[model samples]
Target: MTEAVSRRTPGTPCWVSLIVHGLSATQDFYGALFGWEFKPGPEQLGPYVRGRLQGEEIAGIGQLPPDRHLPIAWTTYLATDDADATAETIRSCGGTVAVGPLDAGPAGRLAIASDPNGAVFGIWQAARHAGTHLWGAPGTPVWNELITRETSSVAKFYQAVFGYEAQAVVSADFDYQTLHLDGRPVAALHGVGHALPRDRGPHWMTYFEVEDTDVAAARVVELGGHILQPPREGTSGRLATVSDPEGAAFTIVRSGER
Candidate 1:
């Protein structure tokens, strides 16, 4: 029951959203897996739906436009005071704006951008909606990370855009680091070390906390989703990466409780 009662700092991972091919099926799949409750946004919001836990907003799901063949993927958004300004920074830092700094009626202004490494994310300036209201526990998001082969350039690019400092983690086999702003861990940047299909490209990965990793991973498979990684034990407990039937990828972790 970790509820975010106030605004997050600028550059924080403020929101995560999914744009999927089938809206209804995505709703049912998450609802049954996480016990989430979904509320459709105003009519003008089209197929937008807000997913919640204990009445606090946790994430969003929207229907993919019929004419677009865009991959079903979850987006991670960073908090900003001005979305337009942030988009400018993205461009100045050698990134590209993939979408608008458009208004979501009362939800605020937002734009999607891809980093120099081609990891796509969003910038959000909160209006009536201040992004996720709850996090850091089971059934809520706990971590966000970007995996790319161009670690040095990506580090410079993000620091230029968001004032982030990448601190290397103590691992010999994995070239990974956490991004921090004002000494608070906001997200992560990891070097893709092993053989992942080249077509996957560099991308941001969203991780959700679950009560039980085995159960959750099994449930994902049961509900027409595919398990990208089998459950594995680590210092952080059991975790796995999975994709919905529509092909959006995300990870689930049970935290330190085994």
Candidate 2:
């Protein structure tokens, strides 16, 4: 039972954004690796920016159009009340909208889809913005992965558009697969056949909630950003992979062990 859409679970992950080709160095490399606090948005929505932490808000940063070849990512948005019937159950489960059910006036009703093994996601409908109200603490947005490669038809196209419920869980050394929704849990699809890198595509990979991922991968290499996997330790904690400084990409965890 994964398709339980009543919206407002704006707690465990509320936000996470990125869609860049260069938004003037993505607000100074995620504002010096997450002290975040950008504001100016709306010039026909080009160089957007919102992310805030101790003062609230939480995520967003935009600017896309380097020919729209798109890939400089970080995307995860789930908090739906009815984004046009969730984009018609994400196009009847095969998924692929790529932008808008529209309206972002009161900061609600957005759409930008992709699943069906392509990954990308977004579907907020909060009206006055009820997301990323500071998730898992630290710098916010704890985790949400999809890293596909067709993994079982991307888990049956997100269990038929978000009523998720996979459950595999093996032990002794990891053998993952978890994506419950009503039963809780909330993300993870991972496969990448040979551990990703055949040119990488098959996305959805966000994770921010840093306290130390090796001092945030050394302040993401002292601000020009570019780590791309460094700190390790998993089971559900210390991780890394950075990019910003005009090249989006994300991942950073420090959340208390799962």
Candidate 3:
């Protein structure tokens, strides 16, 4: 198991969470695939649990509100010193803050927002609960990336909101840029042009590390999830795109510090 640490740097990809319709079934699917144990969390919102591996927090799963119909997807949260200030910056930068900079019962203050391109993400100001606790282990999130229609404008939007230093990849075929914080690459933006998924829209994708991409993909299917993309050789390692039973998509990769 990898060691646990608190990520407090503002603008870093600190946590990934999912709000699903069937909480129990979603827990079952991910538990089987990633060996995650659930622990009840702040009830201020609703039924929520933090996913742990060998007692280290990795991610969060929560129940969706019954009366409200929203997209089933993973949200990549960026760490911030003040969520309200970040929310204002998002609005000034042409992004939309849809949810609250409200309290999660003293655990943290959070706000859900969307980029100008409609890619949803979150801003977190940690108090008692520091974002994600473990890394470089199978079943823990390793990376967060944004997939959008274009990189130039969205890159500026993030740079203004988060103080990220954008470094564009000089390539004729690939329109990509890596966002850096304190000289360390924290997240990335990929311009897929017209190839962006219509159903999912432009969104930030959360990538979980696995021991073996093929085996993990198979396990996802066996546990009632669907493999949206078959295992392929990625620049980092073997990876595959898969979605939970409720159709919330995320990627699994066999690459991270072991």
Candidate 4:
């Protein structure tokens, strides 16, 4: 068992943010679904807004470049010590850098990249901002998982870059692997062959912690969002699949336990 540590220091993970195509619609959609408030940012940031869950900074949303030809999606950002070094390590581990170790002023430096299997994530070097300040709470980010077709390649790539250990868990329903950091489970990897739908692409899905799955599901539809999967009980908690107005998919879990 390899013990892994976050490149970020203690009390990190202060916030998280996503870049989408539409900003107003995305902000309004998520704001209503999660009861979040948005604070506007500069124009260069492209309609950026800080997402607040129960008055705490949990995540953010912004608009992507028009010519990027990228789909509206959510990307997870892990706190790190140095974005440049992290990007270098990602390249050495068979990952591709999509963006730069660019400065975000008060937010910090960031770089966007994809794993060997094509799952996208970000690295953050917090100068003034950490990550999700409020996580594992109602209407906040709870967990993240990378679902990919090439499990072995993805596992090896992330382990090499982050020093994470992959632990396989077997069950009658599904066989999943959890990524451990410092002996603590922080993320999960699911093989696309058996666990996910055939049409699914390699991507990182973020889960928001909620208070009631049913209520959240209803609110999702009410806010013009779509509930891809209704509330269902799982081993971890009550889970639901949802998509924002612009079709960015994400999950929600109502749980008191981590």
Candidate 5:
């Protein structure tokens, strides 16, 4: 069991959000799958709510922008001390800051950006709300990783913007590297080359912790979601890639469950 946290180390993934068209239906899917309760929050955003588990905030779900056709996917937010500076640094690092370093009421400041490889993520300067409150438990985020065409350049971009120390994990056949901050493994990068999903492109994939990956995948299917990958043994545990009813992709892992 891991302790609940109100704050996280800067440069590490602090929050994840999903924007979809049907808020009520999406909420129902995740709530039934992960046992999440919803609460309206950061009202500054048009239609948004925070998903909580046993009173601790787990993630966020909001209505998609009515004007644009944004892909339905989870966006990982990295903790930062200064959103303005981080947004500038992202621009200088050859990344694009598509949204604001603006305030989300008193909750925090935020900016949406994408790496050179076009993997979108967020920079969060937390205030009263310090991102996700609990982790390492069932229904909470356990890992955030970048899946791109190549790791060399995008890794450098993240390192320059967030000061992540890149350590090559598998360089022979697979180009994988772990991103560390203050000597702690915070995130990772995987270069899958031509295998990158044409519809999805490069993106940050969020992995949530569960008690049983197989059961969770089954539950997702029951809730009108789809399993992109069947339960498989991963380095840390059993995991499966799944998408919600709205088509937001995320991974679920059951640690130490062989």
Candidate 6:
């Protein structure tokens, strides 16, 4: 199993969390699916819970505030050193700061923001917690991407906010690009040339690697989750789109198919 020994690099997809109303049900769902062990997070961090794999931090879950009106979904966080500066930059870059430039106790500052096309993500400047501690295996998050039709504006907005150099990948089937930080690929932007049906809006798509995509997809359905896309083989592996009972969508990928 691969493990991360240090903090994630700035501007990379550094962390993820499920902001759900039903914390207990959400905890049980993910725990059974990913084989995660949930532990009470630091008390100063409010109702946040850290999800682990073999005792290594993998992801998190937090109770959604009743005062805030937002959908239940997995929020992806991009690493930053200055959340307040980043929030201001997000506004200046034509994006919106939907939530905070607020303290997350000693875990560092956090700010929720959305790109020009409404793809929501978080800015994290970790203090005591440096994001995911394990990766590159079953049940570990491996990639994050934004799905949108507004490729140019979205790409320009992120580059302005994060100082990323987005390089387009030439493909006959679709329009896609990769965000680079110091020449290393960090994330991707995929243009489907159409809005997502069901008013899903433009959103960040997080991928969690699994031992078997087909099996996971089936289990997701059996667990009362909905299958958005059936399992299919790709160059990298078999993948599928699925959503929790409350309609928070995510993807699963089984690696090394080819």
Off by over 4 Å in 1: 1-4, 42-45, 170-172
TM-score, per-candidate, Cα-based: 0.95, 0.31, 0.97, 0.88, 0.96, 0.94
Q: How big is the positional error of residue 31 in model 6, measured in Å on the Cα after superposition?
A: 0.6
Error in Å for residue 108 of model 5: 0.6
User: How far off is residue 236 in model 6, in Å?
Assistant: 2.6
Worst 10 residues of 3 by lDDT: 1-10
Q: Which ten residues in a row have the lowest lDDT in candidate 6?
A: 1-10
Please list the residue runs of candidate 2 whose C-alpha ends up more than 4 Å from where it truly belongs after superposition: 1-15, 18-26, 29-40, 43-47, 50-59, 62-75, 78-102, 105-108, 111-161, 172-176, 180-186, 189-205, 208-216, 220-230, 235-250, 253-258
Q: How many backbone clashes does candidate 2 have?
A: 5
TM-score of 3: 0.97
Which residue pairs does candidate 6 place in steric collision?
none
Estimate, for each residue in 123-226, the C-alpha lDDT of model 3 and write its tens digit: 99998888888887889998999999889989999999989999999999899999999999999999999999999889999999999999999989898899
Q: Write the per-residue lDDT of candidate 4 for residues 29-133, one digit (tens) a residue.
A: 877777888877634466688887655567879887788767667888876787899899999888899988888877678888888767788888876566666
65-169, model 2: which lDDT tens digit per residue? 767776677778877678888788888878888787888776677788887656677877777666666667767776787776536667876776666778866
- The most accurate candidate by TM-score is 3
Candidate RMSDs in order: 1.6, 16.1, 1.3, 4.2, 1.5, 1.8
Tell me which residue pairs clash in candidate 1.
none
lDDT of all predictions, in order shown?
Answer: 0.86, 0.72, 0.91, 0.75, 0.90, 0.85
Q: How many residue pairs clash in each candidate?
A: 0, 5, 0, 8, 0, 0
Instruction: Give the better candidate number (1 or 2) by lDDT.
Output: 1
Candidate 3 clash total? Answer: 0
lDDT computed for candidate 1: 0.86
lDDT of 6 by residue, 1-258 (tens): 654455666798888988887778888888888898999876655687889998888888888777866777788999998899989999998999988898888777889998887888999998987888777878999889898885777898888888899999787877888999988988999888755654678889999999999999998988879899999987567899999887889999998741
